[model samples]
Target chain A: MNFSYPEFLVKVSENCIKCRRCIKECSFGVFSWDGEKIKINHEKCVACHRCAACCPASAITILKYPVSFKENHLWTEEILRDIKKQADTGGKILTGCGNDKPYPVLWDKMLIDACQVTNPSIDPLREPMELRTYLGKKPEKLEFWHDKSGEIKLTTVMEPQIKLETPVIFAGMSYGAVSLNVHLILARAAKELGTIMNTGEGGLPQELLPYKDHIVVQIASGRFGVNLEYLNSCAAIEIKIGQGAKPGIGGHLPGEKVTEEISRTRMIPAGTDAISPAPHHDIYSIEDLRQLIYAIKEATRYRKPVGVKIAAVHNVAAIASGVVRAGADIITIDGFRGGTGASPKVIRDHAGLPIEIALARVDEQLRKEGIRHLASIVASGGIRSSADVLKAIALGADAVAIGTAALIALGCHLCQKCYTGLCAWGITTQKPELTRRLNVEEGALRVTNLVKAWNLEIKEILGALGINSIESLRGNRERLRGIDLDEVYLDVLGIKPAGR
Target chain B: MKIDARGMHYRELNERIHDAVLKGIKEIDIVNVLGQRYIGTGIGEKVTINVYGTPGSDLGAFMDGPVINVFGSCQDVIGNTMNNGKIVVHKDAGNVVGLSMRGGKIFIKGSVGYRTGIHIKAYKDQCPVIVIGGKAGDFLGEYMAGGILVVLGIFGREKDPIVGRFIATGMHGGTIYIRGSINKSHVAHDVSIEEIDENDLSALKNIIQEFCDAFGITDPNSILSHQFLKLRPKSHRPYGQMYAY
Candidate 1:
């Protein structure tokens, strides 16, 4: 296949020094020196803007194409035209954000019919609408009795103790992959929002140690910076078995970005390439995953909930069932369109199943197995709006994690420039100036605003549905309806066609 | 001090080691510890640990400043990412040995598995070195940006001088020296190979002699009798002018 670079803005500047820094820095070989001046091959560029950032005299500038053509159309006419063209070509639908297709967003399609005639829609101004969610296993059998001292002794002491005021969470973004400022922003946002943000497999930064209660630490294959203390310093622990973008493959952080600080944080040698091995050396089977889960549980003394995170794949329902059987408190599934710091392009575009199908299947399978309530499900990978959240919960997820969406709230344009390590928005880079662009205070406020908006929207939906609490919406498949879907999709989603 | 961990698992051995260290034990003697994985994984601080038997994969992975001296054979990923520490292994180790190691000295008294010293780098005063007493497995020093890897094939008795393919693949910097003839076809297209002259030989001899001294090899004379081949990346300007408009 012939390869063509994505279109980018080219501004010709006379201040070219021909230093060849762009040539040296680009991993994709996007720039070349033509003896007298540096030349950029636009076709090869992924629009990462590393060259523009590295240019000493600021001779290079990359301008992204405007995504919005008109205000009311939702998507630009060009994007709509492109979507139709893809459909005409019999090609798979490809999009960046959480399910950007014209499919009737179930959250938007199903109007909550408020009972203005019979039941009163409780005023949120005076009455409380509880958004608080406890994500862990609930006891199957409860035995309450009095001890010899006449004190009530509970049969089980809730296996894990992670509490969230809001059902929303910020997903994993490691320190080395993202800047410390970004992590701090996410942590502070979680703390302020009464939620949690995961420390994506790269280990927790020392600066974010104080917000330990708001953090969800991860243990991956590399185990680069994991320790007993690191494990204990989190509200929850996630075992990153696979990522949505590149499910089967591992990760590689180039030596150039592995600076002294990143090195120290990751507990690896500075300036050496950090390679996360393809498979967990210790985990070969579901039984082995259980051993690791129990080991971590034993290590943490059951203080924090243990979550198994996997990419949403074809066999996700079966896999999630296995995870539930392994005694995991929660299971997080990331769909195909998930974000990544660095992953092979082939893997990013090809691997994993969609989040919608995976969520529905896993929920159905768990409910059928009579263990649906044994573990809570958290769906991630391209969750963009409150509508998606409602649809996710309706599909059987207790909550959802938002990584790319959170970054967008903090000024990311979804430029897919994270792998380049020169993200202009400061969400994905460690460079001081670029990182400074993302003010942690302002970023936290943006995140808080986003989640706050979503929470209000959830309340509005609930109020319309004549429900006061989010628990009523959980696994309420009766509220969802499928549109323009085939027999297989209908059967898989267990949804009837619209108007039926 | 003598602990036989022949059939003991990684968790059990790690627990025992943790307990011993907590009890203020300065030195540990581990015996018959066959296939026990992650022997000293993520242990921060200095301690003298001696292993009398074979250890499993990632024997000293993510180890910080601890002297791990193994008196027997070890498996894959020995001394992986070990920063500021010393690992002296008396027997051969398995695949991808010393992968991405940054700051440390790994002196193997025997041969190593494939991709030995791959992606090994250096920063400032911290330069990692891996000295192999025997021949290395394939893809030795692959993608190595910094540091040095010295493979002293004590004698060329092993079949297929370097076992594996694509030696020094993607290597942009760093040096790899082997004391035996490497088939020209096996050398990666990206790497430049040259015979080590007297000056290079002397530097290699010093490192090999250190390995000999640590492992009780009385003579470095026979080790020096073989010719040395050095591999370096052909281009600091790799990827060529692919980006030129």
Candidate 2:
């Protein structure tokens, strides 16, 4: 289909003084002074309604495109119902993809059962349930024999390793993309929570070096700020193949955000635009990927695990299998619903596949190949409550990474205004004043609370299935039942219909 | 010590290098080196190593303090994560060279691969340098942090630009001195490109002259004859105030 710009326009009335108030308030550059009144560029707008909310004159109105019979047919009552549901929850809107609200959230159709009869729910406080998981390749065989000194020596291929106290991990958000304070909070929270936070393709900050043990340093196509010390310091090294929000595209940190501190942290010259190309120029084939994987293994001396994170696409299962064979200890699949600091609205909406089907297919493929244990799978994109976490595990995910959810816990309203970088909530912006809005203490607490709640829900789900551990539920499709899924989904998930 | 690595597999080469380093062999030379990937990767201490022939991808990747001197052409990701020490390559280097270096210096006597010095940065005292004696491929110094990158295009008498399209695309803090003319349209809005004056040339002359001195060039004069281009960031505020509540 031919791409066309949205027909609707948003404008602030003549009442606006053009004092650049909206400019200062917005994180996304939606409204700009056109030498007259503040002009609203609909193309740049994420429909976050942040500008409308912050407008003092209340003169701004976002007009929707006039719908002819053809356009009106595209609208459904279900879409309106979903929007209302999000509004009814708390007047807080939840959305997936780059502000486009038409996509289906498969998680809503899937439900989790609670323990009542035959199985009893375990109190997480009283009974200890392990969420910890080890990510790495396991040796198939070991040849052991007693040496001349009477000590047993084993000849086994050394495999890399990374230990996680919980299945949840903080995904890659670079120091340059966000703020130093945000990285600090994530690092501190990850350390305290016994999880790991990723240093997105941007280089690791010096402040984050202290928490290196809990960091997953990323090396993307741009290869920003990566070095031996940065690689060695992290518990895991993630090769960022692509991001869900904007797949098949590279990243560009506008020259405006390349501050001195960020520049120093990222090792780029300050004030210069940081552009990450769409693809790793050198990595053309799976063999090249394998070379990089083994290269990292050789660099770290097989001490730390290596992860390859790619956006969920049409051929994700096949791609994941290649990654496994390429020697990745873990594969992180990001769904189309994943968040990004800034991405072209077009790419964000239509590029990648949904996480639900992607996870199931990848799991089924790997299990069939009998190489499922070769690497752990972590799914991200549109993960909301503890039930979603449980469903994901049952669908064959070892863990999940939450970006927008974590930001919400840290006071992000999901206004989808991250592109402009004026995040009033302070979670995404580099502005010092706006950044203070998100108190690190409270942010950490909220994240901890979210994880704790999810942990409890996980235990509850396990109890209902009569499973004692998370590993038991992983890839255990028999415990799940799809409510109104299609035959293809039912077959792929290997689940029966309700009451069947 | 001499090690002949002809026809040796990547794994075997890695094992031999590991064993040699472990044995405390500080200065060793390898002959007929062919496609031995990940050579001297992640070594902590400094070692004076020499390679006679081509080394494969990720050579000296994540190296801590090892000084690797390559006598011939090298493949992709040379000095991938090199922190300290140096990698002096006598021949052309391949793609993604010095991917995410925080420290150390990479001196190439010949042209380099694509995206060379992409996201290269520096800490307090650890500044990384990728000095290419010949022309560099695309995206040279893409997201450079706080290091000095000098691309001295010394391919005979021709006066071609040292870097290709999108050079210093996202450069923020460091200095990149390309010793030739750059297409101004290719420069990003965030960067300010200016002609290198005597002051700037003087600042980098020592390094440029030192590079020429190593490569057996008699004149650093012709190298400085051409005008140099410098790219720097325009603003400290990465993203303007767009969505502040």
- DockQ, candidate 2, vs. native dimer: 0.26
Error of 1 at A333 (Å): 2.8
Tens digits of per-residue lDDT for model 1 on A1-500? 42222456555388867677777755556677777777766656666565676689788777654443455566766456545545455433323323223433333433323457677666666667878888988788788889999999997667775688878999887888889998999999999999999999887888989999999999876666665568778898998999887788777676678788898777666765666667664466897687568656645545778999999888999999999999889999998777888665546666677788888899999999999878899998878899888878877889999998898888776666576676666778888867887888999999999999999988887776677788888888877777767678778877676777
Query: Which residue pairs show collisions in model 1?
Result: A5-A43, A32-B243, A112-A464
For A134-173, candidate 2 gives per-residue lDDT tens digits of 7777676677889899999887765766777777888788
Model 2 segments beyond 4 Å from truth? A1-100, A111-128, A141-158, B1-26, B44-46, B81-84, B95-208, B218-245
DockQ of 1: 0.07
Q: In model 1, what lDDT does residue A336 have?
A: 76
- Give each model a TM-score: 0.73, 0.77
Pick out the ten consecutive residues of candidate 2 chain A with the lowest summed lDDT.
A90-99
What shift in Å separates residue B162 of candidate 1 from its native position after superposition? 2.9
- What CAPRI-style quality would you assign to candidate 1? incorrect
